[model samples]
Target: MGNMSKELLREYIKEQNFTNANDILNGLKEMFRDVLQEALEAEMDEALGYRKYDGIEKTNNNSRNGYSKKTVKTELGPVQVNIPRDRNGEFEPRIVPKYQ
Candidate 1:
């Protein structure tokens, strides 16, 4: 089961009398979208800078609260991403446009 081919996967599904591949495919697609969204969120975090509050500031500290928003595109379609923000007014995100 660890090294099954695509053809064998289809055969096993057929043998199990399964016909709702759409649901599974959609679920996987959703999973992929979730992962992509996470990547975008992390990108925003890095772009805007982030750090944990430990009651002590480091040598070079830059951290703030983050936010999320929904956006659409013609190629990648729609995505719900977290927009990062900082308190030092030195970070700005460049993904999906600020007005989109």
Candidate 2:
């Protein structure tokens, strides 16, 4: 997704899609949410010491439990994120935080 956003923006400009500032703002908000979600997933991988669905043998006892829906307030708006969980319940996400 490196240049995907730029390509989309080019298409939008070619079609004259954005009529006002709100449209651009909304697009940026959506992009921000996507980036935040990706970061959260990466953080989970680091905390768990494994990527999602990896077939490698478990090095430690802790493992990925699942995900929990979490709505977080951002500068753009409220974005719902899938917070990852560990079996030991010791994974504290620094991106969104547990109590945020």
lDDT of each: 0.56, 0.85
TM-score of each predicted structure versus truth:
0.46, 0.78
- Candidate 1 residue lDDT tens string, 1-100: 3676999878756665645887566544555567656665666556544434446544455666556565544334454555555667555555445566
Clashing pairs in 1: none
Residue 66 CA error for candidate 2 (Å)?
1.7
The sequence of per-residue lDDT tens digits that candidate 2 reaches over residues 66-100 is 89999998888888888888999999999898996
How does model 2 fare in lDDT? 0.85
Quantify how close model 2 is to the true structure by its C-alpha RMSD in Å: 3.2
Give the poorly placed runs of model 2, Cα more than 4 Å off: 1-17
